[model samples]
Target: MCRLFAITSELPCSPMTAITALDVMKEGHDGSGVGLFMTDLAGPWEEFKGAPILSGIFTNKGLKQLDHYMMELGFTTKYKLSIKLPKAPPPGVPKRDVYLIRAYDYPESWEGLSQEEVNHRLMMIRLQLRQMGLDTGDMVVFSFWPDVIMIKEIGDPMTVAEYLGLDRKELRARVIMAQGRQNTNYAINLYACHPFFIQGIATMTNGENTAFVPIREFLESRGFPGYIGYQSDSEVFTHILHYMYYKLGFGIEMYKHLITPLQDRDLECHPNGSFLRHIKHTCRRLTIDGPNCVIGVLPDKTMFMVQDRKKLRPGVVGGKPGMWAFSSEICGLDAAIPDRDKSKDFQPMYLDTAVVGSDRKEVKIWRQTEPLPLQL
Candidate 1:
């Protein structure tokens, strides 16, 4: 089993808050790896909020090639932030040549393109660079998007945090998700880490994904360029979300319905049972079969959690004013928000979709509708 921790704050906060929570749940996950994803970034990143920031590691030569390539493509660096760490790498952690967070201006030709077009372009660039990095084995482009950054390493969560100098880095964000991954589905590959991202959607899971093959096949069939990698079965969750919302036009709440469709009797109790029934029949192949708990974020900063139909995984949601925390263990939340309102804490069952809106200002729980009391 693995441990997942995520928090969204109305104010900017460091990844330490979530890292500390992970420490509390340390026993649940072995010290195999750590992965983090942040959005609505703050601190020194505030000024570059609208610019696309490319986060990655590069060798000395790779950095030069990267700069030359970006220049050739008409991109110019507006700001650059390098995470300064010791020359000597930490024990068991892979040595990084260069840790960079760079903001860039799009090519002149893309100046007036629609946001959708720009997003597609970013995805294409990231995919190309990622494949290039794979071939060279000297650079890794984790993410390239506006106000989003992903960092993954092979080490204990706390140790990776210290090695990265996270506390002194001054990197802060309104939303952050981290996972202390205990690899069971794949070897200890860096790309297999949690907090997977494609475009603006991000997700991390704490349990196995028995339903991965079909889901991967389905997403790949969509002809989306970003759907090729499946280093980890959990990656499918993020694509599932991207497909449901961006492609099919379903609202976030409907994600739970699509992933775990209700039984026929329960489906008939829904207010819009007719519409849902059609979706179930048409998208049946997309349903997930696993004992998993999924936590994810959308481009709009909305954070949500859902569990498989069996509810085999442990998940709890807790919050106070201006903040909400989700974790695989209640103790993890307790450690993060010691003064939180325990009365407001709740565990999501199989059919619940718990959402924390942008800035953590709103909390909502959408439960599956059940049959009304018989007209006796």
Candidate 2:
């Protein structure tokens, strides 16, 4: 199992807060790798929310190639976060030539493109860059989106953070998801790290997906380029979310239903029973099996958590207004936000989903058996 820690606040906070929480639950993970996905950026990045930021590791040659490629495509660098490493990296941390997080102006040819078109173009660019790097083993692109940045490395969570100097004020964000990976299922590949991102959606999972192959086949057959990478079985969780919410135009609440659908007896009493039955039948291949707990962020900044149908994994959400955290362990939550009312800390069962809207004020538990509000 892996340790998942995510926190969202009205004010920008450091990723260290999530890293510290993961440390408290160190025994749950093997410390083989660490991954972070951050949005609603603060500091210098706060002002450039409209520009797409590229976050990845690069070799010296790869960086030069990226510069030339972007320039050829008419993209101009807007702002970049400069990273300065110590003379010697911490023990166990592999040395890399450059760690980049740069924002760029869109190519002049894309001036009149719609937002959807721009998003498609950005994803293609990221995929092309990924393939380019794969061919040469010189780059590892995590995300290419506005107001988002991702980082992953093979090492202890805290040690990796220190090595990257993540404590700098410029790296703060209002929402951050961090995962300490156990590496039980796959070899330690940086691309397989959790807190995976595509377009504006991101998710991290704690347990294995027993139904990975079917789910992967269904998603890949959808003909979506963004759904191609399956370095980790858990990556399908994020794509399933994008398909339902972004492609099918379904509400986020429906995600819980599709992944962990209710039994026929239970669904018979649901307010939207017939509609949900159709969904279950039509999307049966998307159902997930095994012990899993997922924490994800939507395009609108809504953060949510859901458990498998059997509730096989542990998860808890707690904190005061203006700040909240979703952790796999209550001990991790206590480490992240101790001043909140413990009595209000919630652990959703097999039929529950804990959702926190963009406001970050309250957590709404959407029960599968209960009727959803008209607006969602």
Candidate 3:
């Protein structure tokens, strides 16, 4: 099993809070790797709000290739930041070339396109870079989006943080998601890390995805170019979210139904039973099975947590003042936001969607049996 920690706030916050929470749940994960994804960026990153930011690790040769390619594609780097770790590599750690975060100008041809079209182009670029990395063996592009950054590496979460100088650096955001991967399904691959992102939706899971194969096939059959990679079964969580919100145009609450649809007997108790029954039958392959808890954030910054109908994984949701937290364990929450109201905290059970608005001020419990308003 692995541990997941995610927090969203109206105010600028530090990633260290979530990292500390991961430390508290250290026993649940062996730290085979750690994946960090942050959005609504703060500190220095706040200045580049509307521009596209590209983040990844690169080697000298790969860096040159990236620069030439970007220039050819009519992209110019507006600003860039790179962190240099100690030259002496950790004993078992593979040598890293350079870690970078760069803000870039969108291609000239993309200037007049719709915002959605521009975003699609950016995703295509990221996918192209991903293929470039696989071929070159000298670069790894983690993310390319406005106001978002992803850093993933092998090692204990704390050690990885120290290596990146996370605390000393001024990296901060309104939303942060971190996961300490335990490596149950596949060999440790950096791309296989948690906190997977595609388009704008992001998700990380804390348990096995027993329904992954069918889910992958269903998604890939859609013919979306971006659906090709599935290094980890959990990657499907983010894709499932993308499919529901982006492709099917369903509201967030419907996402819970598609993943953990109620049986006919249970559906009969709901006012929207007919519509839901059709959804269940139509998207049966999208349903997830077995023990799993998912924490995800949509493009709008709305955050959510959900448990499988079996409620096999532990999860707790809590909030106070300016923030909300979702974790696999209460200890993790207590570690991140000790002042939060413990009494008001709720643990989402089977088929419950704990949805928190982007502002982090409004939270709602959307259950499988509840009828979703047509307006939402």
Candidate 4:
């Protein structure tokens, strides 16, 4: 099993806080890999919320290719956070020529484009860069989205954080999601790491995805380019979210319905029972049947956690007014924010979806049996 840790706050906090939490739950996961996805960025990145930022590792040659390609596309570099590694990295951490988090200004021609159009272009550019790097193993692009940054590497969580110099004040954010991977289902691959992202949605999961094949087939058949990669079976969870919420124009709550729909008898008493039944039949291919616990952040910065129908994995949400954490273990939560009221801590069951909005005011548990609000 892998350990998942996520935190959201009204004020910017250091990524080290999340990393430390992951360290506390170290026994739950093997030290094979670690991944971090952050948004509502603060520090130096706060001023460039509209600029597209690219996060990834690159070889010396690949860096040149990226520079040339961006210039050809009329994109200009606005700012860059280039990591300076020690001469000798931690024992298990791999050595790389460049680890970059760069923000870029859009092409002059895109000045008046809609946000949706710009988002499409950014995804396309990221895909192209990924393919280019894959051909020669020069670059490994993770994400190219506004106000988001993703860092992934093969090493223990704490060691990777220190090696990457993640303690810097400039690397703060209002929301952060991390995973310490155990590599139970596949070989160790950076792309297979958790905290997968597409467009603006991001998610990480703990537990096996026994129903991976069918879900992958259903998503790949959607004729969407972004749904192509399946380095990890768990990645389908993130794409499934983007499909339901973005492509189908459904509310975020609909995501819980799509992945873990109610049984026939239970649906009979639901207010939207008829519509939900139709959804279950037409979208049956999307339902997941494995033991999994998911933690994610929506485009609006709302953080949420949900469990598989069996509730086989452990999860807890706890914190105070300005901050909240959704962790795979209670110990991890204690490490992230210990001063919060432990009495109010919540452990979501099979039918529960624990959510904390961007305001970070309170934790609301939305249950499967409850009718969703009209306005979402």
What global local distance difference test value does model 1 have? 0.87
Q: State the lDDT of candidate 4 residue by residue for 200-227, as single tens digits.
A: 9999999888899999999999998899
- lDDT value, residue 41 of candidate 1: 90
Q: Each prediction's TM-score against the native?
A: 0.96, 0.98, 0.97, 0.98
lDDT of 3 by residue, 81-165 (tens): 7787898756545678888889987777876899888888889999998899999887888899999989888888887887788
| Deviation in Å, model 2, residue 373 alpha carbon | 3.9
Off by over 4 Å in 4: none
Q: Report the C-alpha lDDT of model 1 over 214-331, residue by residue, as the tens digit.
A: 8888888889898888898888989899998799876687787788988899776777677778888987878998889999999899999999998998999998879899999999
Question: What is candidate 1's TM-score against the reference?
Answer: 0.96
Please give the ranking of all candidate structures by TM-score, highest first, separated by commas: 4, 2, 3, 1
Residue-level lDDT for 72 in candidate 1: 90
Task: For each candidate in the order shown, give its overall lDDT on alpha carbons.
Answer: 0.87, 0.92, 0.87, 0.92
Question: Residue 346 of model 3: what lDDT?
Answer: 92
CA displacement after TM-score superposition, residue 73 of candidate 3 (Å): 0.5
